[model samples]
Target chain A: MPIKSMYVTYSDSIYQFIYFLVGDDELAKDLTQETFLKAINSNPQFRGESSEKTWLSKIARNLVYDHFRRKRLLKFIPFLHEHEQIDYTYSPEQWLEAKNEQYELYEALGKLPHHYREAIVLRKIEQFSIKESAQILGWNEAKVKNATERGMKKMNELLGGERDA
Target chain B: MLDSKLRSLERKTLDEETKNSQLLKLNKRNKDYMKKQKFTYSVTLVLFGLLLFVFSQTITESPKSIQSQQLTNFELGEVTKAYYLYSKRADRMYNLTSPFYTDKIFTTDPAVLNEFELLFKNSEWLPFNGDLTKYTTSINYLFQLENGESVYLKEINEDGFFVNPNTMMQTKLAQQSHEQFVFYWMHIYMGKNEFPPWKIGLLTILLLIFVYAAIKSNKRGTIEKNSSLINLSGLGLAFFCIHKMNEWLGVNHLLTLLLIFTFFMSATVYLHILIKKQEPNWKYHIQRIFMANIVLFVLFI
Candidate 1:
């Protein structure tokens, strides 16, 4: 299909997925745009091995990792962090309040390690089938199932510990 | 309760304005990409046409196509003043027939003349259009007759074809002639030691692209930028390197392309590592420019 229609149909889902990964709404929106651009740029090699949605989700996921990698770079350049633009639009506190429910659980989810967050988001939030999640995450179905269970367990532990504090 | 909240969390999507705006941006980029693809296709087509025109087969003299003024190999006889005429410039082209061109190499030796004679025996010619020098590097084979008449056959150029003496027709020397003539010309021009025009143009383009990409990358101050200029040149080099390696190693082009692409990704990752370690700004900037040019040269060539 032509890219415009593809973008219209998938951009929202891609954006939503990135938002889950990064926990920043505005950044998610930007990443969604980047996902579609990458799709267009690499279109010639799209062998139709998977559904377009899965392919786009994978692209979105990769962009999120890229975003994290760049952010991680700031750890070495502490001074650079001062100059960094902090977008509070989707900070855990603000995002939890805006959503008006699941405050502790959502914050705990944000604190999960990247792999677990990825698994939980794809499996629960996006509601992709195990097979589809595996395809998008480039993981095996067993790994996806393991990650989701552990991720949920860890999330609850964090939620409980926070409440006790 | 946790599952329920999670379900609720999964439910949100981008607002309409954001989604629609993104779509518009994608459509614009898609349009530009289409235009670029078309332009690249045209360039590839023109290059292909030039190649076919250049190395085109010599026309075999046939009874039906013979003309009274048509110069055939048989009518051309033994000569005393045979010289291989060539000039780095095209304007000095036909002037070689008068020994007025700046560069001329004598090839009147019997063995070399025999090679030319045998190569052109019953030569086939085709009517051609355009000045060869504008598009290709070619040289003239001046078979100067003892009587002062000169038959100037353009030895096929780097593009693998050259011009007929009549200037109206183009001909391809046999592959053997092409090689032998090249062997002779290499002796004279190899010492000229100047970069070929195409090389100069390619280097200039690579430098410009590298500089432009570096400036843009620095201005953004974020490593997240994915300028098409960088991608285009990077991929260009990747494909070129793949092709060259394929020739050397006989590996698949696609496979080699993937390997080279991986190298690029690794370099980007390494850059991140460097940035994380807070490499000196000057060093970072210099490496950034160097990396950009390496990809550009690999990509552009």
Candidate 2:
């Protein structure tokens, strides 16, 4: 498919995926833009090895990892941490108005390690199948299943025993 | 269940206008990337062309001193002249055609002629400054050997050609007429004229500055993902080192060129992979490809 069509089809999912990974909306948008730019320039062939969404998710995941790496590097500076806070338009009031359970889940998700958070976001929130998540994460299906199970259990523990039915 | 709540939370998080605007921004970024890629490829091709041109020129003929026709056409009285030409059959030695002969003599051996042609193929006139005071008024036909040695064809005044010419003149002629002179002159010329130590030192300083800036910027996390300036500088340093190695080993012109071209092509491929796997930064990779080619041209040719 042409790059323009792919952008129209997958930009939101890619953006939302990045948003969940980084916990910042503007940065997510920037990374998503970078991801699609990389994809279009690479012009990867779709050989049906995995779905287009999985391929794009993999690219988006790698970009987020790069962002994390840069952040980790910058964390060494003492003053930089004081000045650098995650910038996003979402406010606590807006999250509460949307759904209290969802807001609590977002907070709980942010407390998880990157891998677990990614697993939960893809397998549960993004609704990717275990096999599809494995493809996107470059892992075997068993690993995806295990990570998702552990991630959900951790989320339950972090949310203070409120089981959202 | 938790899954249904997650599903409901994910739904309609972004409006149509936001998604469309995001796509528009992405489209602009892609266009910018393509433009950068196209520009890089063009620069690389141009550098390759320049390298090929210089490589061909270097091997075809060595640069010679420009000669004047005034001396060649002048007639001197009762002056016997002899042409010294290289002889390959005689173990690549200079054999003088008997001094009794007054006409010009040409050698049939290309290897022998090539050696002489490089040093004395062209000529220039220099004022006579030698101890021979009588010839001070006349101009000397000067041919500069690649090693910076000067050969002068001086006219005999009252005395015809001396019983034995100056040993320096004979040595100069013999050196120019030897096949070994080709390699010897090339080494001296390449070492002294092509790559001077001062120039290499300057390039080294420039490379260090580039590396330092890259490291500092990368550490601060202020570097843009698509920035290639550091990579281009690194490639330039690599080319300089390679060219220096070639000069030290005295590699043949054609082989040196082939090696440089191969190194550059491989580097280009590696950088291309980096660009594809990471951000779409084409400027530096392309600049590297182009700069390496141009450096090889300046170094070898």
DockQ values of all predictions: 0.18, 0.22
TM-score of 2: 0.46
Q: State how far residue A10 of model 2 sits from its true place (Å).
A: 1.8
Residues B190-282, model 2: lDDT tens digits: 444465677767776765666687566433222334347666666666666555544343235435656666677667566655654433345
Interface RMSD list for the candidates: 12.1, 7.4
Candidate 2 chain B weakest ten by summed lDDT:
B85-94
Off by over 4 Å in 2: A22-31, A34-104, A110-116, A127-150, A160-165, B1-9, B61-233, B241-301
What global local distance difference test value does model 2 have? 0.55
Worst 10 residues of 1 chain A by lDDT: A80-89
- Best model per lDDT: 1
Q: Which parts of model 1 are misplaced by more than 4 Å?
A: A72-90, A93-100, A161-165, B57-301
Flag clash pairs in model 2. B66-B123, B67-B123
Instruction: Report the C-alpha lDDT of model 1 over B9-68, residue by residue, as the tens digit.
Output: 634567888877878888889888767766665675587467434322211111122123
